[model samples]
Target: MNTFSRRRFLQAAGAAGALALGAAACGGDSGSGSGTGGASALTWWDHQLQLQPAKKRIFEKFAKAPGGMPVDYTFNNPEKLGQALQLAKQSNQLPDVHSNAGLQVPAPQLINEGWMAPLELSSEAVANLKDVLLDGIHIFDGKVYSFPIFDYHVYTNVTWFNTKVAEQAGLDPSAPPTTYDTFRAAARAVQSKGGGAAPWTWNIGMTERTADQLNYLAQAAGFEGNTGMLFKNGEFAYHDDAYVDSLDFLLSLKKDKLMMAGSESWVDTDARGRWSAGAACYYFDGPWCPGVVLSAAPQFAESLGVAPILTPSGGAVRTYHGPQSGDYWLTPKSKHAEAANKLLSDYFTTPDYSVEVANTMSQPPRDLDAVEKSTAHAEYKKLIGWFRDTVFLAPTPVVKNVAITKVQVETKPVEPNLGTIIQGAFTGDVPDVKAALKKLSDDSSAERERAIKAAQAKGAEVSLDDYAFPDWKPGADYTLDQYK
Candidate 1:
């Protein structure tokens, strides 16, 4: 929707900036059980989600004097997590640990099928993770399941805008559109300004994007639907009238041409590019988006304006943000489970280590002291305040059967690609709203059934109710109002 370059951020931001730090992993032949003080050789399978500098810094930190047992580390693209896990299971060579896409699709299923071992956290550990892990994300049967790994925390409909565009459109560059009325009006004003540039960029094309867009709208409607894959339960309902109304509202914006034509196909990176280049007046995104923009287009930094999402009813949905995974350390089904435990325990609890990790990755650490030292810590402090004060950080849902979930999405393809799905619905591509919704519902239900059958074949007992989490019925007995 918006066309910006990423090269600028790459050149300006320290190569080491925004690096992701992970637990010390031990693996490979050089690492033997001979080391008593450290973990034996254990391989850590990671999806290299960070830029080069961050990765190098992280490896350098772990490149110690072969600490008792050398931990072999490796990183791959995130999409490989599932395939890699499957291959590992078949080969019996699963890494000592790996990251999971928490609270989405397959994660919950895997957890339910006992594919993951519950984390047995001590009182101290639990306290250490309070903010990062939150109370609801990691607990299972009153016991800690997965260690909260990370979260992609932020609010919905909120984006980083180009001050230049705002000024040209007769909007105050310094102020954000705090209410939906103002926001919509600004969109029209930007359009009226009539530059080749667009007023807004959206990511509503795919099922995931569509879902997220709808979720944000639902939240705006004062409904609490979780955007994460594990979205289920009483806090939010998928089939509520508000859910449909929110979709309708968004479609209205599309019909009015206030949003970009290709809103759906654009991913997070694409959206940032558009904003960084001053291609649009506004770009809907989270806080991390600003970092990405600043890194890629520092020249546009002064022109960028950040704000929270606006609600049509004048109600605000507190921003929801977190590390992508929420802080997880899995005990690989290995003979070295004990050593793995020790390394992870030391890694997470080490105040100094946490500080370094947080600083390197440009993230807020779970540890209070560590978080205080981050380079971006001050801004993160503001973000944390936003989370604590202005935002309600909802616990992302974790679904069961991640693999089956993947198959479902691919099989039940969205119309004209993901972007078209959103644009089409809103632009009158599919005039019949009820029919389109029914199609979506039917696809989702079929996918769920497929997942159920697959789990059953694996000797897993998963009920439909358990599968549908964070989702609530509109006028039904269960509603998000209870939590508020």
Candidate 2:
């Protein structure tokens, strides 16, 4: 769910994930009595509302639990939590433990900037979380920071449909088409006959998703890895056939009038709300959509059916996910690092907590075995099946060369990036999709080269070669061993 999850948040989340908490307590002030409640109470910040019940049960019993301390827990949506954290960081106040949500920078940079502390965990704690650990992701420079709390095989393009609408369109809800042409045809059927609502809908108004949707759609077009940079070589491929054709497919939906009205202005939740109420036939989303739909459109629950994103000509699809990363992090400034580590290492990683994480379903646990005893909804559990069976774990430049962090740190953003290019394409600001994509690819590569030179100047041994992974395959996990 990265396009919808953590990694793909590289954009619009620029500031939105910081809502109430951004202005509320200024980050529990490291659990000081001034912000949280009382002295020595560990303040925790996260945006995972679905995990609230599990977290609450733990916090309520925490003081009595191992590594337990009085916890001052705060929850907000991603935007608000991020805002609060950024504000807190600026003010020199950060929570003892918080999820790595809003700050979209690479984890290594986060640590280098003093936004994180090396989690001084016991050897036993490290051993317990070892199976889920990855270098450059949870661990950096020989120190453990955090381990993955969620599964890695996830993406943004899970195709969800309203059963009622499928029947109305004379398509099988249980077995929707997986081919691009067939899927588009089916969408057209839905528009012409399925309740007179838009055939398909998404929050196109959210520019970031346009980029993300294109990311996964490129896979459906039979491309491998992320659309940002082709993993086969250390080069940007924005104008490559995969991305250009994928964008063309998206543009066709708009030109053919299959997109929902107001989609141009709808945010994700709004589009989901409308889709839930039978206003659209299909809503292309992520594994987490079922949970969101359950809350945002409860009545749509029984009528909902989820399937993997369709591929062009049903080409075997492989929606790749970036390396696993820890959600929770600690600010080095916190006075309660030990207590925070205890909470994270001693308690949070336990099978009991994992079962709770599985039960939440909005965010899947790193190990699907946790689902064996989870009480998650059938729809939620079904989505998990797709994630396990279809998604791929891809190699990362960070893993290939940890020094890549310096390049990330030095590389500044280029204007009219993928998101803006997609926006311009749809709004007719850019009439030549291929040309725009080529320019984007070239510009990004140039920026990266300059960044590499800049980082080398600073004595960080890195280069564009760090981005290439020649041994990577289409359908398998690109584990650490494959990096070199």
Candidate 3:
């Protein structure tokens, strides 16, 4: 985003510089609680940083609202939260209300390890969220441990443009560039009419995010699932032409000198500042883009506009997600079970809470209907339409057979995974991108089979078929009727 930034910012970003991440987590005064020296106190921990202002506002109201308790609220970034929760698990210091967002462990393992306690919300409360709930995803072992307060039908590759940058560069922010060629043209146009900022920028320093955009772009290029699982043959297929083409397309942008100089080393947070300052013309990010802009750079928020993702072939981009599931979990150690349940279920589903969450515009509320009537930004409302059109619900292995979670737990990560491969290509480490992808695909397949066998030996009834969905078609919804 800047010489002071692009060079100096991200070296200490992400995992390498995360040693004191626990201290980074701000433990707010639990303004309201059971008042027994943290005993039976309803504590809540979240990983969302962008909406802290809104969260605080909600909690402040909640403390005074019906059924609200003194929530000792805390915040952690996802990476640190993963580490914090792991340690908490060992020490039995798990927060009564925490999220499984970055744990990487499957829900089954979390449940079996006593990571959760059932909310047992009233049927009325459960029915209020029926629109986004999935049988197996929101339900585990016939009990609801967690349920989403937001929707997950979002992708990371939406064509986000600074409206000011676009119009000045002779491009229509309303009609965003829809194809690779046009996207490049828009970048060149913006660069030619530069106001000191570059035409385009990305958080390429964030390997995982960069990798996600690649997979998502691959899906736009006609791949099936978000990851390399074809589901057609029930196997990993990361080396397909879709992946190569997508990676090639991204590399082409860098090669063409259309990116902000030194921007490759920046993370999304870095790019956000640039984008908010109107130093960037285009970004590929998700629903939270607008909210973050509004919060961090309000002056530039009005200039931010979103369009559907720019696909390789100008086709509908389908970002596949499984049924909405619980993000927040109640730890087994919670003594404020009744109060915690209200915070977890009753409050989350309440109309007032949903409206506040929807308006916050980080993750959309589970109630899409509330979004229409809420005070959310127009860009956010537009995002909802895109989600309905482009986000398809895919079948999950855990949904079909819960034991597959055990297999997932057994499966080890294949190194130089897609994100790293893409990052290597960007950094000129990987000479042949296609070959690297092929090796990754093969490695993933072998590892998956090995894990399946190991889990089977342990009496987990998972098989290759558990992952196969022959009925799945690219860009189409994997309906429940076809779950067999």
Q: Across residues 390-412, which tens digit of lDDT does each residue of candidate 2 receive?
A: 78887778766767767777877
Q: TM-score order of candidates, best first?
A: 3, 2, 1
Off by more than 4 A, model 1: 1-55, 65-95, 102-108, 111-127, 130-145, 149-157, 192-195, 224-241, 296-300, 316-326, 329-343, 349-373, 377-383, 393-431, 434-484
Candidate 1 lowest-lDDT run of ten: 17-26
lDDT (10s digit) by residue, model 3, range 1-484: 0011211212211111000111111111112222122763467776665556766776676677677766677766554566677887898778887776446665666676788766657565765655554434555544565666666576667778889878888787778888888888888888788566587888776666667677778877888765788867777778889889888888888898887776667766777667668888888776767766776566766787887777876755677766566767778878777777766555566777667766767666666678888788888898888887888877666656766666766877789887778778888999899899899989998998999999999987778887877777766777655754
TM per model? Answer: 0.63, 0.86, 0.86
lDDT of 1 by residue, 1-484 (tens): 1111233222211111000112111001111121112245566665423322343454445545234245666554333344555666677666665554211333334554445555544455544545333222343323444454333333435545787888888888657776667878888989998376788876543234345555665565666444312234422234456556666666666668887767655555455566568777787654445444544455765676766566666653543432334344463366656545555554554555556544543333445355456654233345544444444444322223223323332233333332344556655576765556556555555655675576667655444544343443332333222222
| Candidates, ranked, lDDT | 2, 3, 1
TM-score of 1: 0.63
The whole-model C-alpha lDDT of candidate 2 against the native structure comes to 0.70
Poorly placed runs, candidate 2 (over 4 Å): 1-41, 63-67, 79-81, 122-124, 295-299
- Computed on alpha carbons, the lDDT of every model, listed in order, comes to 0.48, 0.70, 0.69
